[model samples]
Target: MDLSYTERERAFRDELREWLAANPPGERPQGEEADYAWRRDWQRRLHEGGWAGVHWPVEYGGRGASLMETAIFFEELGRARAPLPANVLGLLLGGPTLMVWGTEEQKDRYLPPILSAQEIWCQGFSEPDAGSDLAALKTRARRDGDGWVVSGQKVWTSGAQFSKWCMLVARTDPDVPKHKGLTYFLMDMEQEAVQVRPLVQITGEADFNELFVEEARIPDENVIGGVGNGWKVALTTLMNERAGLGFFLQVRLRQLLDELVEQAAASGALDDPRVADRLGDLHVRTEILRLTAYRGLSAIEQYGQPGPEGSLVKWLWSDTNQMLTQLAADVVGPEALTAGRPWAYELLRARGNSIEGGTTEILKNIVAERVLGLPRAR
Candidate 1:
């Protein structure tokens, strides 16, 4: 596939690059609330500039960008070091999935706020009992008079405290098979039945939360796709979880590696032959990742889906990011681990890279069974 950008695509990139250069994001604040507010404002600015929903259908106030241009948007956002928009879950996963499964009325009601960042969204798919094996989730939603009453616990939910809605999946019918008995709901987060408790990670941030949903009431109109078809609807959200975000994270890895190289050169760490060799290896791997990702993007656009041949680059990007951060500690020494420093925070945060999104072991099993076409164990 030709990796070269067309003239129009190049113009798109240049325009965004210029805008970002002129309006760089200010230094993030100290507290979580402050940081979140800053990101929300940044997203507002992106929307005003006609850049936030570049790929959403134009009829829904998007630019209607092609798939490649959408990829360019995330890559440029990452290269600019701008934090993702605070309504990211809504923009990337929620809105897109709604477009796929929601009725016309649902789209009209939800898509506008999503583009404007008026309503933040969070995903409530991963229960404490079902992280990797989502099908094993026990969250239950029983039918009510004109709606449903849901009760469960969801862990590792980001932005729940700030969200107005949740893309929630619950067991609507336990009699049928686990996957078939599920239903998707656009749950209102402002209800008293919902609670969000922050979880502080090693990075000294509470970016994730535990959601205790106790008898939350959702109207039948909030039902997405249909009852008993949530497994399929949720699949749409899961597929989008990594699409553009993979490109952003890969660019972040590349940026961190570049910084490491510059720091090493400045401090004369390059004198060590072993250190130099390792850096070279990392650089090669970064380039390979970039190439493979673009190739995967091409495959995804040409075909409706990225086939088995197209590797899930997020898995590799996660591994590489951890390694890159560790190397920074070695090369930069004690100073790298000094609290409050960018390198220090990055090193701490990298610890969860392998576990978050999906674990390496589980991802390996998926590849073995799905991509390699290996038989599952009896």
Candidate 2:
């Protein structure tokens, strides 16, 4: 199969590149507050330029672009070194889930705000005891009149404090099997009983939080799919998550490696064969990831969604990110011991790539069973 972009695709890439050059992001901000403001403004600019919601249908305030075009957009954004839109949950997961399963009124109400950056969203999927084993989540949502009352805790909820809403999953029936009794809802974060407590990371930043829901009420209309079909609704969002992989990772890895190479050369560490070999390995791995991402994009263009092959890309990316950060620490030597240094912070942050979204072990099992058709380990 031919892997080259068409003439129109090349023109599209050039157009995005020119737009980004004219509207580059300003200086990096210090805290989450500034970061959110910067990203919101950036997203608004993209929306105004007709660059946001490239994958959504035209009826929903998008450009009605094909999957290849969407991939081209991501590629150009990475090439421009642009920061991802701050409301990633909305663009990547929530919007798509709403598109597929939400009622017409829900989609009409939510998708426009998401595209415009007027509403930020967070994912409330992971619970205290349900990280990789998502089906084991214990958060409860019981029916109450025309709405559901939610009462439970969600841990590691990224960007919860600033979000206006959450794409939440909760167990509606405990007696049934783990996957069969859950429901998904679009939760409003402004309710009286909902509380967000920041969880500080090793970098001394609190991007993630623990959400406490004490009788948080969601209207029945907030349900994404039919009752007791949350697992299926969640799969839709998870599929979107898996499909959007490699863009951020590719951007981050490229920037970090460039900085590491410069630092190593200036510090005379590049002369070491061990360091050189490690950097070479990282470069090769990154190239493979790039190609894998392109192939996945190709599949999405042809099939309207990516296949399970995305698991390979996700697994490789998490492992490579960890390895490269460790190599950076080695190159920095004693400087790595300094807390809050870029290299040290990067190493600490890399720890989460393996665990977040889905754990490495879980992803491996997916590839083994789904891709390789391997038998269960019993």
Candidate 3:
């Protein structure tokens, strides 16, 4: 696999780097609301500069960037330490999923707001009982007059409080099999029927929310793919979820590793063979994740599907991040373990990395069955 960037690709990276240097997203505010507003305004700057939807088609108000260029865009964002737009679910998962399955009117109405951050979006796939086995979701939406009334509970919804729309999957046909009976809806989150309560994590922050949706009404026009085809449409969103953010995440991991290495060097821990060996192993593993992510991107761009590397990268990233944070605790000492410290927060947050997006165990199962051609574990 040729990993070298071409002249044009290098030029693209340079231009993006220049833009980020000029228009950096300054310090984030203290409160959650202020921080969200700060990111919203940053997204507005990206939209104005034609950088919001870098991977989107030019006809759809994006740059029509190549796959490599898209990776570079994310890399630069991480390198500059810029926060992702507050409407990340919209830009990454919702808009792309809509582009694949949305009608002309749907695209016209939804896509522009997503790019501009005028409307935030969130995912409503996971419930209290159905996360790993997403097809087992119990949330139901009954057909009403020219619409549907949805009622259920969703957990770990990242931006539900701020989102204007939710890419929701609910059971619309109970008689059929679980996987076949689902329907995808663009559920409106602003109504009285939808309630959001923050889930305070171990980090003492509510980065996620539990959505208690009661009789939430959705218009017929808001059905994403079709009735009983929600599973397929939701699969599209899930695939995008695992694939699109890999680059940004990998870069962030690299940054953490760099910081840890700097700390180790300052503390003179790297002189020990054990410390050096572990650090070396992490560096190699991190590079492997980066390379594997690029290979997966190439496979999708060329073959229209991902290889095993896609699953492997996420698994490696989560494991590596957890390791990095733990190593920081050792090298950076007590400060890293203290409450409210950035390292402490990262250490706690890394625990959920293995579970979010997809779990390590589930990914291994996918790799075993799909990639290794092994028999399914019954």
Candidate 4:
């Protein structure tokens, strides 16, 4: 497949770059809340500029652009070094899931706010015990008169403390197999029964949280697909999550490569053959990942779904991130050991790349058995 951009695509990219330059994010305050507010305002600006929901249908406040256009938007966002939109969960996961599996009423109610960044959204997938084993989540959503009474805990819920809504998964059938007994709901975060306690990371930041639900009410209309068909609905969301994660990994790796090149040259480390080889390896890995993402984008444009190839992209991204960060630390030496440096924080954060969204071990299992038709390890 020729991954060359057409003249029209190049023009589109230029237009996006110009718009971003005109409305760049001014110096944001250092606090998390301030940064979040800045991101939200930036998202609104994108909406007003008619560049917010490039992938959604035109009737739903989006440009109805192709998958390549969506890819272009992300690439441009990275180029600008802008903070991610505060409503990324809604834009990437919730919006696409609703578009595919949500009811018309649900779409009408949720899609517009997501495009405008009116509501920040979070994912309530991981529980205290269900981080890697997602199908084993224990959150329960019991039937109430006109709604469901959601009661359980979700851990490592990123951005839940600031979100207005959450895409939640809960157990609705105890007798069935783990994957078959679940339900998905759109939950209100401000309800009296919902509690969010911050989870502090090694970066000395509370970017994730543990969510406690005590008889939280989820209206019947808030269900995404159906009662017990949540596993299918969740797959839709997970597929989108995998794709978004891959995009982030590529952008981050590019940033790391740029930094590494600068550091190596400044430190005269480029003269070392090992350092040179590592840099070359990272460059090749990043290019391969970029080509894989483009392939996924092409598939989405043609077939309307990225399919199982997304798992390959996810695995490659996670593993490459972990590997590249290790190389960065090695090259930076004592600077990487320092606490406040970006590479140090990045090295610590890379530990989660193998664990977040889905673990590298789990992703490898998926690619081996499901994608490659290999025998199960167990």
The candidate that achieves the highest TM-score relative to the unseen native structure: 3
- The whole-model C-alpha lDDT of candidate 1 against the native structure comes to 0.89
Ranking by lDDT: 3, 1, 2, 4
Model 2 per-residue lDDT tens digits across residues 13-43:
8888888889987776887898888888889
Report residue 268 deviation for candidate 4 (angstroms). 0.6
On a 0 to 100 scale, what is the lDDT of residue 112 in model 3? 93
Model number with the top lDDT: 3
RMSD of each: 1.3, 1.6, 1.1, 1.8
Q: By summed lDDT, which 10 consecutive residues of candidate 4 come out lowest? A: 240-249
Off by over 4 Å in 2: 303-308
The lDDT for every candidate, in the order shown, is 0.89, 0.86, 0.91, 0.85
Off by over 4 Å in 1: none
Pairs in steric clash, model 2:
none
Clashes per prediction? 0, 0, 0, 0
Error of 2 at 184 (Å): 0.8
lDDT of 3 by residue, 47-121 (tens): 999999998999999999988898889889988989888888898899889999999999999999999999999
Better of 1 and 2 by TM-score: 1
